[model samples]
Target: MPCVLTPDPTAQETPARPTSTSTSLRDRSSAMLREHLRPTIQFLLVGGVVFLLDTAMYNLLVFWSPSHGWGTGLMHGTPLTAKVLTIAVASCLTYLGNRLWTFGDRPRPGTTRSIMLFILVNLIAAGLQLSCLGFSRYVLGLDSVLADNISGTLIGQVVSTSFRYVTYGRLVFPKH
Candidate 1:
């Protein structure tokens, strides 16, 4: 007896509606999860680094600087100045990390528009943080160290970090 092999005719046919099938749905969901998980984890890791750097630098400047130090006098208090400077540094670090690792899959690499959008997002985050600080200090009249830390670092960061993650993915490092 002789044997012959033939290709299945259906093997070459493409599905007209992939999404309507259960298998397709499962596959699509799994793929979506995998795709999002990578960037989400990387973004979180980069965010931790940026947060630590920004907070530590902000505290250093706030505590170490003299009352009338070079940049301290520009703002009425050192908290605002420290936050501004540290956030600037953190923003740069974040941009580099997200560009190189988190959202590296973006079509274009380091365009001026991307950088500007990143900066704009960071500026908005800074404003949200500053508002938290102001509310804690002025509206609530809670100007103690603990209060300030809670308001600015915890509350403000929670808000701004959420915003940053969403916007960075959607605007700064959009998936083509």
Candidate 2:
């Protein structure tokens, strides 16, 4: 008679496929990420447009020398004023874009309260930008356009944008 091997009953077995629970958990995590990421992406796109607009407006107000004009800018010798004006306009655009697209799915709060909070948050963000600009202009005494752009546009914006992103989601557009 030919010898036959017996099956071992004590062997450990590895799963050939993922369990349904694990797969469902992964799917849920992916969906949550997409939901959050979509708004962030939209916010950044809107911010990009607003940034370009703000840059153009600021440059025009601070550096533009018209053919028939003798001044270096419409707001010559007043960089701070120009920055304020540009920010004001950009704030309006930012509000509309965030409301209509970025946080569109969020529940709407009272219009008056929401607008007030939005303004307050923007004021704080603007203060961050202004502080950088002022430091570059007054403290550091760097008055050149290059210095202004580096401090106000680049550095300042980085700080302010970070603040705005966090505050806008929490205060202005609560998920609840």
Candidate 3:
């Protein structure tokens, strides 16, 4: 005990290290991606339902009406008429789905206001689809049923759905 001294055990213990920058950055990136993707995923899920309803209604009105001899005059098995009716019905379904699921967490507006805004957004989207159909049927002279589906249902829907998703998120269900 004359000269030798023992080291304090506490002095040798190291403090816990803070998270590395790389780790923190990675975590932040992952969190941001998840936050962004969640709404998009929800929208697509709702859209799938809307699309099924829309396609089914469209086919029924266009093909079934002719066979069943249901419609008359302008309401008959015209592509425009079928599209209008199917899209109207689909828009209603879309509104319900988006309100209940897609933007459910956002603050809900008054029912009337919400519906009006939703309808307005859909009108713009519908216009886009209609334009595609008109161009294909009239301008491009590709009036076949296949052409109508390609131009209006496939191409136009892709574009309009993108526009609708952005507008609905920003305008209809804005963050507070």
Find the candidate with the highest lDDT and give its number.
2
Q: Give the distance in Å from residue 74's predicted Cα in candidate 3 to where it truly belongs.
A: 9.1
Model 2: per-residue Cα lDDT over 18-58, one tens digit each: 98999999999999998879888998999999998998888
**In candidate 2, which residue ranges exceed 4 Å CA deviation?**
1-12, 16-32, 68-71
Q: lDDT of candidate 3?
A: 0.79
Q: After superposition, how far is residue 165 of candidate 3 from its true place, in Å?
A: 0.6
Spell out the clash pairs found in candidate 1: none
lDDT of each: 0.82, 0.89, 0.79
Model 1 TM-score, 2 decimals: 0.77
- Preferred candidate (TM-score higher): 1 or 3: 1
Overall local distance difference test of candidate 1:
0.82
lDDT of 3 by residue, 92-166 (tens): 888888888888998875767778888899999999988887788778987555686788788878988999999
Per-prediction TM-score to the true structure, in the order listed: 0.77, 0.83, 0.76
RMSD of each: 9.3, 4.0, 6.6
Candidate 1 lDDT over 6-124, as tens digits, reads 88987887667645588788988999999899999999999999888876676666544465553333333657666788788888999999999998878776589898998899999
